[model samples]
Target: MIKKLFIIIACILLLSSCSNRVDKGKLNKVGMLVPETINDQVWGTKGYKGLLNIQNDFDVDVYYKEGIENASAIEHAVSEFKQKNVNLIFGHGFEYADTFNKIAKKYPTIHFVSFNGDATQKNTTSLRFEGHAMGFFGGMTAAHMSTTKKIGIIATHSWQPEIKGFVEGAKYEDPNITVLLKYTDNWDDGQKAVGLLDKLLDEEVDVVYPAGDGFNVPVIEKIKEKGLYAIGYVSDQSDLGKNTVLTSTIQQASKLYDIVAKKYAEGTLQSGNLSFDFQDGVIEMGKFSPRVDEKFQRKMKRFVKKYKETGDLPK
Candidate 1:
């Protein structure tokens, strides 16, 4: 067990330390596709941050197309990348996957990555996180801090494995806890998310988390305006309003980008599949903002240790 953990740790160190570029000549172009701009401060921000980090680490030239919504736009974007023989294409959000998979289907030579998704192909891989592992933590934190047992989750989509993972995670932590969960079916609509937040607030949910891509700005604002607590998502967003945010679930974009770009450069890139669960450190909790209680801190520690030691959540 120690050996396995040490190896995982070693891989992490190596991946983090890797920065040698084999002269990222203009040989192959890379495209980083986003459903929204980095201005959103959530998923798109993390993805865009990943793109810049990769470019900084390696000498590769990156082409980015941001604010792509809808299947047609995504399809067109992928098609554009393939026509340019882009080395690797990174698509953010599950909504972009079907379109990417369709475009990647005909282009076997190009490599593709779908972030926050679990779809696959020979040249395309789906990379997802076990947010369920942390969702329990989020829930417990919310439960502890919430004046009402009512906590809320505003997700980007209605239902999916990732969302289900959060549901299972939260319920596993407290079966009797009341959670008000909803989805906007869109990632860019802060107005919609704000409206949802208002509704959840009407339900008396004090602790909330917005799991939409970059739409967290408004959510955090609402949390602050109402003098409530919230858990941030995608990146380490506690800094947005440190007083209002407890902690956050960060999808390590640069870390994933490092591994993918390294493997692709090494010609040993794993094809057809890719994923990073919480156990893999792909999903991590941000530093807790100041003033979090010892009780909630202990809960997070216990849950993390339980998962790490037993490879399962505590029931």
Candidate 2:
């Protein structure tokens, strides 16, 4: 009777251990695909850090391949993750929308997530913020700080949403303020931004706000030389131009990743789009420049308070 009881207890312990191993294995597999090198400081780097946070928090197996640009490359990378049976996959840009939408059809079991994108499929989820909301915050600062009553927004493309928000925000501060809009054909070309800056300066733009990634450095450099003010985007680029940059509108990428990851781990993450905004705390305002006086800071605080309360810009 004692021998039989021991045999039954050992069999039960072995089965429980195997079951636990399988469950832990399923929870550990997380993969990410970055469109560019993870060293880009703002966009790519933030995504990388977010994944790292997810790994650290969940104690999961993490894999990432950077510089995977284009539809074919994204497809290949995601396919490899699928083969490895990664439980979740994150594609960190809007550019991955179509590819993820297409590929997600084949893998119904894996959860696909996108940052700064739309989720069109059932198995996919997206976390995107309104760029215009952040642009509005920057524009409001620029309008208030401009001595010339003229401000400029520079970007690689028109980006109507951000431009519209900038204009609206400026008009909210002072209806008579002039808002100049300039677009460089390329995002990284410093010369293009310089040429655009010359035009904006010719029109007496005293506060220049750069919306394009990487364009902030060159534009801020020129703004500093001209003894003018500027606003940064994506990251807190105040360090890039301390006295010149009045403030920045930031994207909290890692925080967003952690939010989604927790939901996923809890098996509560849903499909479709998750639209984040200033109200959602994903779109944030960076530190105010020392040049920004306490009076204006108080006013900004009030504006933000009103926004949070009403879900609309203060009139």
Candidate 3:
């Protein structure tokens, strides 16, 4: 009777251990929350593409909610995902960082990922793009192509490091170049960005960098109408106008998503705010327009190659 009791106890313990173990292969369900419509053809679209990449690579059940900006909306989306037993959740912008951290505590087994913000919880991570170098390169391109020696940047906010990099890069190319800066204070305000562009044009700014993804395409169109040069942001905009848009600073969002999913599947993804730069192939310069001279293009190529090899930008 004692031997029979011991066997029953050992078998129960073995079953409990098996149940507690996480099957890494079964980490298939993924959820994503975006701040705006995926039809924006820039940031929002890129985010959706990232989710698609994860789905294609991992063969996971992926779900997404658009216009999930507010905390209440976020909570609702997360709750729904929880019901589906989502193993991973992606918050596509920095705005989701704080809310995700708070929500993570409730869903301890689920990992949360966001972009460009601080992550505090063990189950959360913020992927920050080191875009300063690319911004610098964009500034250099603007400076090289600007006939007026006066360039302008219309950005969503003043806190973006790319703004500082743009200034420094333009000055690096031409010390006497004038860089005018304006802020829209909101990302999706195209009319406001155009109004700012007009203000810069009035100041005789011939080159413009519309740094917000929400308004870049329209701003580039305006720049084309004015026959002025522009530096595209987030994605390649050379297709907007071959002569008008000089080059673009690209963030390879799809690739980043694949990498993140792979790491998570391997159980090697670390928590915290992680940073990626040009070396990681996450940040890159898009195709240059025919407007950029060959001599300058070669120089730009050399700069990029050196930067990638040494992780140093031109001083």
Candidate 4:
């Protein structure tokens, strides 16, 4: 019975393709639904870039919808994509996994994919970045670059395995390093991020970073105002705030999008979990500002190797 079910699922997966204009071989349209603004230059931006990568590299046409937050909104978005006959529907965040999975099931002929999402379902695939290890290196970089030996992470959400991995990364950077972690309850509340970073500054923490998307910019500005340090995530952000940024541990999620979308076009779309890490250089550490110094970079290089070797940060 199990063998039969596997065969059935495999058969469905093989038939994953559906033409947009008609049920033909080539796909002329791809739809991207985003939870945040694409110009966020952070989370949503990475996704938009990925979609563009696929669009530019292939013969398929692309359509995008952004700023989807509510549960109902996500469902509506997926339904809309299905109606338009998008060959591939890309959801940029894990937040959309549940809805995407459901909609994909309803439209198995339509290809669906998510970035940084863990859930798996028939006709649906999710990909996640190995930010835990990269976050560890980010934390280590924070440790080496900080003048106070005390750092802060202004998260936009309470916490989860994913965020915990970031915290664990910080801890392993130094058993003695004190990490002041706090949440701003939402990602777009840049003022709140600034306030949280301000409080950390009162405690005399010279370096602070925000792990939440779109929240990093404000705190980075605040860090500059207080003559402190900050880091970026999701994209190469060293150029975003010249001297204040220590570095950014960026996830090139868009790059992955390019690969998956193309494979999908070539009749080679595989249904499974896909991951990228620092060792693969998919997760890149951004260039540090001059303040980071030669010693800090050297220390980070050694720690990076230690991380690739052991699958964890140097303790």
Clashes of each: 0, 0, 0, 0
Best by lDDT: 3
- Residue-level lDDT of model 1, residues 175-272, one tens digit each, is 76688788887777788899989999899988888886557877897789888888888777887788789888777876777667766776767765
Quantify all predictions' global Cα lDDT against the true fold: 0.74, 0.81, 0.90, 0.74
Off by over 4 Å in 4: 1-28, 158-173, 266-268, 305-312
C-alpha positional error of residue 175 in candidate 2 after TM-score superposition, expressed in Å: 1.1
Candidate 1 global lDDT: 0.74
Listed in order, each prediction's TM-score against the native is 0.82, 0.86, 0.91, 0.82
Residue 229 in model 1: lDDT: 89
Residue 136 lDDT in candidate 1: 66
- For TM-score, the strongest prediction is 3
Clashing pairs in 2: none
Error of 1 at 159 (Å): 2.6
The TM-score ranking, best first, is: 3, 2, 4, 1
> Using alpha carbons, what is the TM-score of model 2?
0.86
Query: Deviation in angstroms for 279 in model 1?
Result: 3.0
Give the better candidate number (2 or 4) by TM-score. 2
Lowest lDDT 10-residue stretch of candidate 2: 19-28
Please give the range of 10 consecutive residues that has the lowest summed lDDT in model 3: 17-26
Clash pairs for candidate 3: none
Error of 1 at 214 (Å): 3.2
